[model samples]
Target: HLERLRALAREVGLEAPLYTCTAWGGAAVPAEGFLPMHAAYPFTPWEPDPSFEPVPSREFLFRSPQQPAADWWQAGAFRYPIERYPYAYCELGAGIQMTYLHRPLVPPECTQALAVVALGSGCNWLGYYMYHGGSNPPGRRGFLNEFTVPRLSYDFQAPLGEYGQLHASYHRLRLIHLFLAEFGDRLAPLPVVLPPGASTLKPQVTNVLRYAARAHQDQGFLFLSVYQDHAETADLEGIALEVLLPQERLRLPHEGSLRLLRGMSAILPVGLELGDGLRLRYATAQPLTVLHARERRCVVFFAPDGLQPEFALARQGCRALTVQGGSSAEEGETLYAWPLPGLGTRLEATGLSGRGVELLVLSQEQALRCWKVRLAGTEYLLLTESEGAAWVDAGEERLTVCWQGEAQLDLLSYPRLPSSLPATGLLEDRGTAGVFWRYRLQCPPWKARWSLEQPEPQVVRLRLAAEALEGVRDLFLRVDCVADVGQAFLDGHLVADYFGSDLPWIIGLKRFAQPGRELELILRFTPLQANAPVLRYFTRERLPLPASDGTLPVTVRAVQLVPEYGIELPWQE
Candidate 1:
C-alpha cells in the first residue's frame, strides 16, 4: 500500500513519508496496533475495534483506580533499534471517543497528564489521535466506519469537535505544545533517564512520586504526571521531587517542597540557558514560550497550579540584575531566588556577557489564552479570553478570526507592532493589558436555535431560523436524544445514522446543503434491543441505560444550531 502511495506521491507533486501502521495489540485487531512513531519509524498504529478505554493504546501509563492493572504490559514503546528509530510517539491518546460498551468522558486533565507521562517515558515527538473529530463520510453502501464506531458521527471527544469547535482539551494540551515548539529541538537528542523508583512507579501507587528526566550530562527537563485515567489517587502533598540526571541527582525548588494536585503535569527546566549568558539552575514553573521583540526577547512561563512560581538563577554566570513587577532575593550567596507572581512579573537581567535577558510570567489561565501568530514580519501572541481560532492571510490582505463560543481578543506583538490595527465590528481598543491590546467582541451565546417537530410517531423533523445560515461558513447541528439508534434521511435516502448513547451528537449540515434547494433532515428512530446483552455490558462499564418498558425512548430532548463565522478584517501591517 505504501509503495503505491509513494508512486502516487511521485506522480503528483505531493511530499509525504509513507509507512505501514501496526499495533502491538488492541481492541480494533488489525486496525488497532502501535501507530508507528512517525512515517520514518517502522511502527504504525494498530487500533482495535471498540476500544473505549481512555488511555487504551498505552495501557502501562495508567491503572484504573477501581481496578489497578498490576500486570498490564508496557510494550507500547516496542523494543526496536534506539539509535536508528528514536523512542517517540506521534499518536498518543490525548483523547479517545467513548465506545458503545464504554461511555467514559475523558477529563481534559488526564489527556494533559498522558502527554507528560509519554514524555517522561522517553517519547521525544508527541502527537495525538483525533485531536480533531469528524463524521465518517458515507460510503457507496452507507457511512464509512468500523462495526464498533458510530455510523456517521466520529466525535472522538477530541480537542477540536466535529464542526471545528474548540474543546477544553484544546487549551489544556497547547500548554505542552507551546513548550515543545520552543524547547523540543533541544530536548529531542537528550537521552531519557528514569530514576529507580520513578521508573517502576505503577499507576495505582499514589504515595510514590512518578518522574523522569531527558538530559544529556546535566541540562534536562524534569517531567512528571500526577493524573491517571479511570483511577482515583491521593494528592501528592509537600513532596520535593528528585530529578535524576546522568551526572548526579538534584532536588527541585531550591527552597521548599511543592505539592502535586491530582490531574496536573509539568516539565521543569534544569541547567538551561535562558539567553546567551544567564544559566537557570532550576524552576518550579513550566516554560510556556519565548516572545521576541526586535529590541528584546521575553521568555514567558506559566505557574503550575498549587505551586509557587520560583526560579533559581546560577550566580556564576549572572553579572547584573533588574527586576520588574516582582522581587528577587539572594538564596544564600550562590544563586538568586526569584519568587514570582503569576502575571505582570518580569525579570530583566544583564548576564555575564552584559546582554539583556528578559523573563515574563503569566498566570496559567493567561498562558492558555495565548496563541502565537505571525502577522506581517513580527511574531505576536494573540491572547484570547476564550478559544478563538485565527487565520492570517497577508497576501489577501485579510485577517479572519473565528469563534464558536465566547470570545475576547487581545493583541500583543514583539519586536514590531503592526503599522495599524483598526478595531472594527465588535473589536475596539479597550486599552493595553501590559503588552496586550485588549478587545471585547459582542457576540451572543447562540446564533440560532433549532426548533424540534415530530410530524409523525417515531419520527423527528427539525427547522432552523434562516439567520443560522446567513453568514455562517458552516453550520452544525447539536442533537440530544433518548433512544438506542436513529437513522437520518434526506429526501428518502439514508444519509446518516446515530447510536443514542452519546448525547449532543454534532452533525455537519453544510454537506447536505444544496443551493436553491430546500434541505429537509428527517430522522427515523430504530433503537436497539432494550435488553440487549451489549447494553448490559455498557451498564457494567458504569454508563447505565435507564431502560423504560423494554423499549428505548426515541425522544429528542434538545436541538441546537450553531453557526461558525470567520470575522474578516483588513490584514494588519
Candidate 2:
C-alpha cells in the first residue's frame, strides 16, 4: 500500500513521507505473532508509596539498534533513558494528564499550575491527551464496577483547569496557533534544532510532523473546552479579515445552545453580538459543509478560496435561484446573484402563517412554488422539474396524504380455556408452501391472546388413573387459536371464524365447540394464511382455569421440533 501510494504520489507530483512506528503496551499483541518478555508497570501489581516518587516496576522497554538509557522518556518519542532495557519508550501505561484551552473551566483554580511539560519539551505540536476532559460516551448503566470508566468531568490538572468558563490555556494555545499558522510550512520541513539556554525544555531534532489537516499544509489549530457552548468567532486583529483563514471563530448567538459536528470541516461559528451584523465564510467543498444556527441575524459565507462574493443567508419570502448562465442569485429587493453552473440554490424561511404563501419565479411566465406552513409556522420548499408547485392550507390540523394504499388487516381471537397447539405437517416434497401446523389462539374471557405457528402434531396428555383425580376445579380442554384465512376448530368444533382473509389468532373457544370433557382439535386452514405454525401444548391440570375468579396460573411446557434435511448427491459411501 505504501509503495503504491508513493508511486501514485510521484506520478502526481506529490510529497510522501512515512511516519514512525510506536509500541502499544501489551504482553501479547493480538493480531501479530509475537511473545511477551514481561508485563507493563502500574498494572503489574506494584504498590504505590506515600512519597509519590518514581519506583521501578515491570514495564516493557524498547529493543533498539543503539545503547540503552536510565528512566522513561516522557517528552520525545525516542532518546529517552531506559531503566531496564536498551531502547527509548514512547507511550506510558495510561496515566492521567490534562490541558485546558479554548474555553476554561467553570472554576479555573483546580487546574491552574501544571502545564504539559512533557509534549511541550520536545514535540512541535502538543495536545493534552485530554485538556478540557469530559465523559466517555454512555455505555451500559447500573453494572458492577460501572465507575471503572472515568467520571463525566475529564478535567485533568493542567494550566487551565476544566471548570472555568474561559481557561488561561485558551489564550496560550490560540497565540501558539496564530504563531504556528504564520510559520507552519517552515516548521514542518525544518528539523527541530534546539538552541541552548533551555535545559528544562529538552529539544531533540526529528522529522516528526505531529498534527495534520488535509491541505498541503494546515495552518490553524482547534481547541475544545469542557463547556457545551456554540461556536464563537472573535475579531482576530492585525490580520485581514478576508485573508486570515476563511474559517474562524464562532459563538452561540442564542443562549444555551451549541452546534453538533457531523464530521471534520472548516466551518466555525461567527459569534453574533447583539445589534451587530455577523458575517462568516466557509470554502465550499465536496460533502458540503452545513452550518446549523438558530438566530436569523447570523449569516453564513460560502467563500471558496480564490473565489469571489461567497456569502448566503436564509431569508423570508426570498428564493435562491440558479439561472441557465451558471449564476446563482437570492431573490430580494435587487435580486443579488452569483454565477453557478451545477449548484442549485435553496431558500429557507421560518415563522410563517398557516394559510401559506406563494413565491413566484417569473421567467417568461409565472413559475411559482407554493409552500404550506408547518406545525411550527415554518415553510419548506423543494425545487422540482415543474416550474410551479401549489400549496393548499392544511387547516388547523396538519393534513398529510400518507401513501399507505391498502389497510393490512388481521383478525385475532380471544379464548376462555388456554391450551398449547403444535405447528408443522408432512408434505410431498421438502419445499416451502406445504402445510405446516401452527396454533392461533385467543382468550376473550381472560382478555389474553396467543398463538403457535408451524407446530408439530403432539399432545400433552394428562391421564387421571381414577386415583390421581385430585383438585379438579373444572375438567375442560381448551385450544387457543387464530383464524388467518379459515375457521379454526377445537375438538372438531369451530373456535375461530374467518372468511377470505389472512391473519394470526388466539382463539380457544369457537362458536361450533367449547372445551368440555374431551380435548381434540381439527384446524381448517386456507391458502391465504401463513403455513401451519409451530405448536406449544400443555394440559390445563387445575381446570376451570382460575376456577371462578378467572385468574389462575396456567402452566405450559415447550416442545421444539426442526426438520431434518435429505442427503446430498454424488456421495462415495
Candidate 3:
C-alpha cells in the first residue's frame, strides 16, 4: 500500500517526491515492448522450457473470457482490463490511449478537448507514440515477426506519420503545446470537483480497501477502470472528466441512482478512441499531461493527483521559451544572461539528446553556430554566464540564445551518447602454426574496413614462410576482403575492387569473394569521422599469391547480431 511506501520512505530519512509518475500504456496489453502488438499474429518466441513444450508465460497467445473457466486456467491465462470487474461498463474494456502528441489527420478539436480535461484533472508530463518514425534496425535473432511489426516508418497515424510527413494530429498537439506555453499554471493545481452520488465510476471496492488508505501523495492517485465503452457526457455531479467527447453522448444508466461518495482518490480510467466512430479501448490512468488550446494558446490538462509542475506559466501574451543556463535548472525558474564576445555574437543551445547540454551562436535570426558537449562525469560547468532563451514552439526542445537576457536552466532527459567501442585487437584463431597467424579483426562503428599494412614485403613473406608447421595452409595463400572495401594485389594475377557501395540488409551476408591458392591477404580500411580526427597509416611493396580453385567459402557465424563478427562461409540460401 502507499502507506507502507510512505512509512518506508520516512524510516530511511528519504525526502518526499522520491519518484516521478509515469504511464505504462504501450501498444500491447502486458505493457512490455517486446510483446507482440497483434495477438492474432504473435511471434512464436523461443521459450527456455526444457521439456520441448511451449511455455505460455514466455510465448505469446490469445485467450478470451467467453471460453470455459477450465480453459481459462489452461496453459496461457486470459487477461481482461481491471475495469470489467464490479461494473459491466464497456468504456473500461482494455487498452486505452491518451494523446499528448499525435500525428496529423487526427482531429485538432478532439486533441484540444482531451488536453483541457487532462489539465483540469491533474495529469502533467506527456509523451506520444511514433514521435519520429524510422526503419527498424537490422533484424536480430529473427525473433521479430515481420507481419506484426509496423514498417520502419512507424506511421501508426501519429503526429509524425510514417513518411516523415506532418499530419493534422502533429499540428493539433503542437498547438496544444503552444497553448500550454501560455496558461499551463492555471491548470496545474486545478482540482476535479465531482458532484453528488457518482458511484458507478468510483474506485472498485478492492482498490479502495486495499490501496487507498496507504497511498503516498508523492506517488499521486490511482486510475480506476469502469466497464464502460466511451465516457459519454454525464451531467451527474460526481464525474470529473479530463476530456469531453461532445460529438457523441451516452446518457447515464437510468437504472440506478448515481453513487455520490469521495469513492477514493485512487485509480482513474482512460479510454482510447481508435479508428472511426471513436470506438474506445479501456486503459488505466497513468500520470501524463494532455495539452489543449482555446485561442491558439496551449493549456496542459492534469489528472487529479497527477503531475504537478514546479512553476506554472502565468503570463498571457509572450510565448514560453526554454532557458538553458549553460547548465541545469528546475522547472519554472527564472534565467539570466551575460555577454560572450569570443564565442560569436550570441550563444545558443541545441541538440539536447547528446550531452543533454550544448552551446550555440545566433546570427540575426538564424542559428549560426552550435557545439555538441558531453559531460565527462556527473556534472559539467559553463564558465560563461549569459541570458538563456529558447524558441519554445511546439516541438523545439533546444534552447535559443537571446540577444540579451539572464536565466537558469536545467537539463531533462539528456540522452547519453552510445558508448565507444574498444580498440580493434587482431588475434589469431586457426591456421598453419608458425607459418600463418589466423588473425581476427574487430571493427568499430567508425571503422568501415579492416586493413593490414605490410612494411617489409618480407614480414608477411617471412610470416607466411614459417608455415611449415602442420595444419598450416600454404604461405602464399590467396587474400580476400569480405564486405564493403575493395581488394587489390601486387602480383597482377588477381584484382578486385568495389568502392562506393552500401551493404543492403535485403541480401543478408556476402561470403568469401576472392579465389586464389597462394596469395598475400592485405586489407584496406576507410574511416568515417564526424568532425573528428582520423588516424592513418601507409606501407609499400604488396605481394601477390598464386590462383587456386574457386571452392573456398566465407562463413558468417555471428549473423546479424551486434558485433557481427564471424566467418562468412559461402551461403547459397
Candidate achieving the largest lDDT: 1
Estimate candidate 1's RMSD in Å.
6.0
- lDDT of model 1 at position 415: 32
- In angstroms, give how far residue 165 of model 2 lies from its true place: 4.1
Name the TM-score of candidate 3.
0.23
Which residue runs does candidate 1 get wrong by more than 4 Å?
1-79, 243-250, 320-326, 333-343, 352-355, 387-397, 406-419, 423-426, 442-450, 455-459, 465-467, 516-518, 524-548, 552-555
In terms of TM-score, which candidate is stronger, 1 or 3?
Answer: 1
Overall lDDT per candidate, in order of appearance: 0.63, 0.24, 0.24
TM-score per prediction, in order, is: 0.80, 0.21, 0.23
Question: Looking at candidate 2, what is the lDDT of residue 146?
Answer: 22
> For model 1, where is the 10-residue window of minimal lDDT?
38-47
For residues 137-241, write the lDDT of model 2, one tens digit per residue. Answer: 323562221222222333332233332212334433332343244334433332211222222221121111111121112222211111111122222212112
Q: State the displacement of the C-alpha of residue 399, model 1, in Å, after optimal TM-score superposition.
A: 3.3
lDDT of 1: 0.63
After aligning candidate 1 to the native by TM-score, how far in Å is the CA of 50 from where it should be? 10
- Model 2 regions more than 4 Å off: 1-47, 50-122, 137-151, 157-165, 194-573
Per-residue lDDT of candidate 1, residues 1-573 (tens digit): 545655687789876554434323321212221234531111111234333233322333522211223343433333333344445455666566654554456667766777777666666667777788877777886556865666777667778877666777888888889888998888877766666543345556656666767777779888876765546666787788676656555677665788887777888888888886787878888888887666566787878777677777877678766666666777543455464654446777777667678877777777776777666656666665544443223334655566554434444433333545554554565666664555655444444545678977578887654454655667777777655667888888777666656445667787777765556788877655666544532333333354576655455666766666556666555
Poorest 10 consecutive residues of model 3 by lDDT? 532-541
